[model samples]
Target chain A: MAKEKSSTKPESPAESSGHGGGGKSGGEVNVFDHLELLSAMGRDFASSLDIEASLKRAIEHITNYVNAEGGALFMLDDEGETLRCHASVGPVEIIGLTLEADQGIVGRCVQSNASEFIRDVSKDKAFHGGVDEETGFTTRSILCAPMSVKDERIGAIELINKRGGDGLFADSDLHLLEAMSASAAMAIINARMAEALVEQERLARELELAAEIQRSLLPEPGGEDYPVVGVNHPARTVSGDFYDFFPLDDGRICFNLGDVSGKGMNAALLMAKTASLYRCLGKTVRTPGRLMARVNTEICETATRGMFVTLAGGIYDPKTGIIRLANAGHEPPLFHRPDGEFQDFPAEAPPVGITPILADGDEFPEIELHLDGGTLYIFTDGVTEGYLEDGSELEVEGFKTLIRDNAAQDTATRLDAVISLIKRGDTALRDDLTLLAIDDAKGHAARQAGESPEPVSVDIEAAAVEEELLLSLTVPSRADRLKTIRNAVTEAAKLCGLGKDPAHDVVLAVDEACQNIIRHAYGGSPNGKIKLKICRTEGELIILLRDFAETIDVSKVKPRELDDVKPGGLGTHFIREVMDETYFLDPPVDGGNLLRMIKRL
Target chain B: MNHEIKEDGGAVIVALEGDVDLQSSPDARKVLLECVGRKMPVLVDLSGVGYIDSSGVASLVESLQSARKTGSNLILVAVSEGARRVLELARLDKVFTICDTVEDGIAQVRP
Candidate 1:
């Protein structure tokens, strides 16, 4: 291939009319005739916004116009530091090749930003023989031009081995190739610009979607009966603490405020899962204690144990003026009374999903508050535990005072005052602060004034539906029969809801209730058969379960206190939360345990 | 919106049955592009349409791009009350010549 270089260098201009611009001296064309042809070529090349196709077409033009054997175009790498081959017309194998500065004729054009006409390759010290060796073709005379836009040299184009010719590549050939390279350079620049614009647009779309997912995870502000005020201020685009609320049957509203262990996407995901789990159980579970127990067991089974969630949930019964609440290892909730005094509800048990199970005889404290004309404030640690300018944590007591002082005003004013107090001596909230305030005064007033409105009944029974597995049983009306059925339903539902076991948690809760009634209430009494009714909703499973046991205990049962740590006698605790409703009704002839269990589907 | 067109040996027709405002313009555009890109002379039926907006006009223009690409034609039929007001507001009533009835629109597209 190197020996053919000497044969292509044409020694005389007289025999090379077709090789250069000298053939255009006939004077039949206009002054800008060459410019017009070049402009037309530029327009044709630049019209296409496609990078790969534009480069390929430019390479073809370089080979045909310059009368060379083949040509290759090399561009700067993404970082714009190294020259990588972009297009080649003649040699298929050498297309998309790479060359470094100071390497070959292509490198010299890129480094010097000048055109080079080499008539003989073996005599030129800068010539590299790799292309010749790969193509097995003669590298005779060569015309190389710098591919630059303005003063910036992006790459170089090299036309190798002039076809049907001998002698050095003329000056006019260099001029024509140089003009072609200018347009090629502009095409390369335009393509790169378009690619960058496309990349930026894609990133913006992804960010918008991420923002949407984050917004969807948050609970809606306020509710139908409960005028709730929810505020979540994330330190970044997303935060770890999440709060959610969903309606419950029998005029109860189930809501939870939770704090995940960390922040960012992982914590956001965990927050979503935790909120969903709490919402699911809140719909199924009847009371706070039972809800915490079911949630604790499920979280322990599925969630990372070390990374637990501190959640406080309550079912507000506007009809009875009673709020049944159970807390799992979270900040103590603050209650601001009409008398301008602050009382903190204690979170007597560890956070749910961390412990394996509620121990027998362990007291699960359930707080039954008769909400009067006052406000209930639920917040994350970000509000009180935040550092002040003096580097002091506000603590629970300080937050309580703040709420008590501000509760007399409108809800918005009260919230603003509370936040202002927290940020009094600080510039910004150091962590994400979440505050939820619900006004109970209006409902309380309506009830106290002897104008009783109908309770906001969200019937979960309407949504109870089951598809995968069904458990149906009819046992005799014996005291033991009720206990056995309760135990079976509760166990089934819990295992089913827990991700790993795949057994339904609602079914298991029902089973536990049956077993408790059988062992304690009937005590081997002679009675007819009992019935357990289980159904599923679109998002929950409802158990219209009933059992006949004459001695079913209704009143003297001690509700599980949160401080007790034993496990065996938690049947009542589980029943209260796992089943949406549990009522001991008197039979048409005799009293019996009439329990209803609802589990999220 | 109603569309009818006759080009070469084929015909195309489009029919709309609801408000063709900004809210429903995306659906209108998708359906119109389908008719034009198929190289069928087109007819658009706007007998039941209650409204149209500038967004609807833009979608119709997009159909023109596809019609030109496939070498077909598009014609509108039975302009409604609210739709005609929008087309008049945009001065597009002059741009797109209208046919009074579905039969007239179809005849305009017949070879």
Candidate 2:
């Protein structure tokens, strides 16, 4: 169409070239008119937000220049099975017309990426007359050009019935349409790319806001001392699994864990809804089964697209050592006996959001269990389905072994150890992991009567971030006050990479030294005061003990012989056995003694 | 310190709780001596002991000697972590008759 290429300056078609001075040749368009058409298409196809409207205008201008009665721009659907008219200008409104990609003239052009010129439509086998028969438009000649770039076939453009010429499309008309279709194809692809970028940014922002709402809906983490402990590690920025526990007025704790079906924003939104329903309805509805029914009723009315939530809920009384629980299609919660026995309770009803009411009369089935110095473990399938260190799935048995391995530790440590086991550093988590442990508080209390306080769980991440910590305390040298000193020392030792046996040994050594201050320093008098200062710097613990009593003979302090089989001097032996260095320091005041101890981490 | 004295299978079981140091070891010694006076068998459960000092160990040693004089068995059941370490420091673990559980302690005493 353009023998004269695009120039630096804009020029009128007649002045831009003189090729058409001989006035039009047989069945070909005027060179000046063709130049005008090409220039117009170039200017019109750029910078358009409404792609369909712009294409409609471009097709209208092309039909006029080609002197055709009508033209339609057909585009292939996503699946490429059919062609639909995206833009059309004709005597009949075939704008939204559709045809199978293998059945019509336009379809053939799109499939083959070639242009077609039908001089007479009556004899053309590729032409379908369905639109003509339905719209009462007369059959005539047709021109179809493939709208493609390289090998990609976007669609095809069709024009019919040349308007004042011999009522047929010519070679020049095919050339003009093919050139324009290529430009249109490129414009459509660019416009689609721009649209997709915009849509992606919008969805990202929406997902971020929804994730924030989900985090806000979550509850605070339970500490080691709390009998009920829960932990969650999300596979993605948002999770479909959630758990919560809160104390009730009647000295009982209510807890629940749930997993919503599906993934992405839809699943996350449903999870938030189900979690809120339980937190609100779990308070007044004492019976776990009745609470589940109310939650199910609310979910059934609102949850769409066949989404559902599997959940388990229970109320535990610390005084009575009993729990009343209800399960709804969740993984069976495991009850581990103190005797190393495991019993599983399976779900008896379907998950919520399937129906409004339960099939078994009114509520989900509930179980009453007594925790006799044992613990109940509730977790999602993510833990079992997680990959182990050897790359095999941590089936139910593997997960139970993780629990049993750390069962000798307290409840919080058991959960941490299990989480650290299945946690992967080289690959993303296959699913979200959520677990909860309900301890038998009353049973343990009856056995642990005047025992010292339990140690709190260490925050390993925080310990890594902080390299130094100082613990200072001053208390009377009394036997009852020794436990407080032991707890503080244990935490410091754990932070310095000394835990389990090594940490216990450090605590015992300190306890023995403090006992000497009460017995020997004060000479069995309760009137003396004691001070302790512990500091960890660069992975080394330095302990200082200050006593306000008569100074002892340092050289004479010794452990009794093993053959003696006595007890009073074992304190001195324990201190020498555990600490890397132990010596007496000069007292800061005149009337006291300072003992220095150091343990290399 | 607090303790519970129960007779199971002809063995006097004395379960001690809390820290047994200089201040509380005297009470533990009195209880152990009373159980030994029964002269059948004595099982001291150290499972509930949090922090037992040298004086507490001395009380156990005195009770064991008294128990031997009467020809009655003196056993330790469920010894706690802290108590076990203290016993091992002076090779007392080799000297004492220790069992893993109360059932084992009762079995050994009866047999």
Candidate 3:
């Protein structure tokens, strides 16, 4: 592009059109005619809020009225730092283009907050030649005006190259352009604000839908004939914490509680996946350790970076008064024994989905407890981390004391008491709160009647005294010999007229107990001997397994935390789940331990 | 537990029987990993398997990871109800390439 110099100064229309000189070739229009056109343009600008279409019309009117070659309208971007070509009707298409806020004639008009009318192309220092160079559109004279609403400058409009008469813009053209820009600026601002509101409403509706889907995934509280109760309270509309329990076909309940890292939609989505996975895998896996490992593998494959799930879950056999639990990097559950003693089984492994915790070398410990007449309280960190009005936390000790205070209440009532204690005072929960309570209903009932707290003992003694010896066998404490022991136990169960389900359970229990003896009691030595005795009565089947190995430390033999999600340590869990009553008695004076397990028919 | 391995074209097919629990998963993993090590397509037919525990699932996961590393395809065929439920519970039903029968599984690998 070439720059040319022009030194003629623009005059006002009053100075140029004075004396009423008539043109010979064409009809002359007066100042009153321009006023009518400005009035009509103002009316048009006020009629519609479609900023793009209205601005296009306004630019068209300005260029046509002034008889210019073309015109373009620039608008301030969201950040208000640059000018963008929002609408243009010119020789070249520069729409969607951008320029610095203080770069050209248009920028000068915005900066000075005034209109510019030039008769020369190069003489004015404010004139920029970059647009002519880019679009190859030569310019001799131009009119530029700033567009603004209130005191805030929005952008500028520039009409290039006057087309008629002397081919130079006068002060009248700047006057008309300024009037049109004022209305256009207001229309653009109003339209943009409306669009933003619509977008916000759309997003709010979507979040509501997500919350509904999450609510449907939560299970109802309580189970029939089993004193199991659970509750979940989310800090936000959507929660990362979840708990679930459902009856399995074999007269047992499988339950789980998990807390996904983080909160809101991302955590909620993972919580749904983890909870459903537990429900599905918990049914067939039988062993909590194995079930958790399977879930960890799947979550590890799908979870995003820096995301994981801390979980505790188990299967409770109401008929056997036994519970097998597994923990994965979650807060240990509080186990309340009948003797008013409480124990916390802390995590045995890292949380799932963080790393490979279930591979060949990893270990997932399982805890097997005979509930006989006690309660197991499983919860998320939300409970222990709850804050009081003074900003002090109710740590694990405080939570344990809370449970101890409510120990005499039923399972549902105890859960409520704990929840109230955590939510007491003027403190708000910082995380999703979830709790699950499993109670031995028969034991609770016997305790309520002020009888001996050993409800399980009474039942076992009644059966043992009236029972008949079905079969008895002795075998070496070897992994290889477990199959023979299982076979013998199965035959004895069948002879007692037990159904396929119960018989299978009896065989599995005996096999697992024998395997534990071979591996744990005898340290995997094959030379040690084991004795098996089977008896059946009117309402129960009892089995006694004796091992001549060193006396087992009962406290040390407590089930390992299932959270480890490893490949082993599930034998004790299987034994407890399969049998109704299990007792690891102190070794006799002769140097042997007797494990007596009774399963009610 | 018992497993039978066969070959068809460039793919290896293995059919498993009995419960795939902690006690049996190691053996299943050995056989499955060997098939995957062939660096070709492998298909596991679990129609005869009655039960599968977490360890069994872990073995399958290992095979899957190995198959991805070797650029070989691993598919499950004729998954029994027990296995299918557990796989769905773990959400692996969506991750694994599963077919209703061995014939369909073979077609998937070949095609």
Candidate 4:
């Protein structure tokens, strides 16, 4: 574009000057003098869009054509707020200084929206002195005009030290500068617009990639028997908070919701990694508590030194009607009871991946709820710390009130109302918000209320016999070993003539037992020893695995969901699922941990 | 399982040509998902397959698990001695309908 204009400019100006006819200027007395000169000046000014080259050409053309000694062109900055020296030629020493609309002779032209002609710089109060000192020259005259665009004064173009042999800058010099200023202003505006378009294209491409990654990381809505809903709304193109849910075996639903500390692409990228790690490890490990533990370790290993994630994850047992949940310094979960009571469980701890040695006994938090018909609502700080109109943060008390006010609405409507309130009350949410709600009403329907069954004693002898036959004698505790144990036990139950259903039970049971040893006893160190003994007893095949390690406090432990995707402990639920009877014991006085598994044969 | 998928006409011939063990099961599952994703009938030939573990069998079972919904069929063909020994040892021979050759596996496809 610049090339076409530059080429056209020279031809038009020569034609107007009648230079192509090779006629010399006829002694200042022509039939059409000002008309020819004005046409030639317009051609010279309209030639190029390259601000640098056009400014250079304009200054030279003004000096030679109008017979001016020096000139300067100041173009407006992109914001239209400041004027900067863009180009200059001859003896105008001050080339790069900025001039505000009320600062100097040039500024006065922009402010008054008119041109100025000064015969002597010493007579003007606005003549900034630094230029004369550096150039070792005295400014004799100044011709200044506003580079106005659509009646808006963008900047001022000034010509100095005119040379018409003895007179100061006349009306013709000002007229010539005004014409050049108009075209130069147009060129500057066009160049800035083009630059903005290029930058926007680059940003659009980056956003596309981020959206693609975010979509791929989200879990599908339906797969297992239970129904689930997951939503993410980033304040920008991407969010630093994420939520994911997938199915697990034994009619369990695994899910996690997390938030990274910062915002933008960096926070979004970290959120993606955190979500992926939970999904991968959830599929590999069955329990939520263990999943979070491992996810914490992995994040600590790869994340920025101080980076951490506030996460909450658990598995919902659709059959058992229980939710095994764990938290990593995240918001306390809000519970809405079917009877209209609301409670927010505050079993919070430090955020995951923040510390290597979390308080061993006290820091490990496990909270279980017999979520008969209650709703578990989890969210990021963007929800709780949402800004109120007065700039104060919305605390948990306000959120509880919101839930209480909207308790009668359906689950979908309730969630929508909550989001609306947050948006209305807090126009400026300082962080990203993520919310997840799950209800186990159907699971509650499967059971009769108030049915009390006496707890039966576990037949240890029978479980030990079952474990002996099914389990691989003593294998190192790796995920691979878990696979080996799952397969071997499944096959043994089938061989024992327990049929397909019972075989699945035995497989799930043995997996839990082996995992307990692997997680709590061995700690995935691959150096610990675990023994398996499988046998048959009284219409059931019994299995017992023992590890000569620190005794596990069976009473202090809560049953965890086997398929909880994000990390935490899920050992006890796997036990409940696979075995008709589960028993935990410690050797009389020694440090040996025993887990017995039994399935009716 | 080391999956080597080759297209033959409209069908895909996925050659399981190595030991299908615990470590290789995930890769096998991914290949099966890809085949189903493309809506192709897959004849998984186990003739060159040397060994099969429970995890490998689980992958094949998962293929059967999701194939119907994905509108695809997965069949096993040409089980070698080593692989057959392992599958029979794990009692999965009764679970999967096996064929003696790749042609028979393709013939066993219902639709």
Top DockQ hit: 2
lDDT string, candidate 2, B1-111, tens digits: 899999999899999999887567778888999999998899999999977877788889989998998888799999999889888875799899999999999999996
lDDT of each: 0.64, 0.80, 0.75, 0.67
Q: What is the lDDT of residue B5 in candidate 2?
A: 98
In angstroms, the error of model 1 at B28 is 69
Q: What digit string (tens of lDDT, one per residue) describes model 1 on residues A323-398?
A: 7676777888887776767778867787765676565333346787777877778899988887755788877777
Q: Over the stretch B1-111, how does candidate 4's per-residue lDDT look in tens digits?
A: 366888775667788766554345567777876776777777778888765544456667767667767777777788886556545545567767788987777767746
For B1-111, candidate 1 gives per-residue lDDT tens digits of 343333333566567876553235557887887777776777777777764433456677667656867777777788886566555545568777589987787777777
lDDT of 2 at A584: 66
In order of lDDT, best first, we have 2, 3, 4, 1
Q: Residue A547 deviation, candidate 1, in Å?
A: 13
Worst 10 residues of 1 chain A by lDDT: A559-568
- Model 4 per-residue lDDT at A430: 67
User: Given the true complex, what DockQ would model 1 score?
Assistant: 0.01
Please provide, for model 4 over A319-339, each residue's C-alpha lDDT reduced to its tens digit, 9 standing for 90 to 100: 556788888888888777877
Query: Over the stretch A150-189, how does candidate 3's per-residue lDDT look in tens digits?
Result: 7888898988887757777766667767877776777676
TM-score of chain B of each: 0.84, 0.98, 0.97, 0.82
If ranked by DockQ, best first, what sequence of candidates would result? Answer: 2, 3, 4, 1
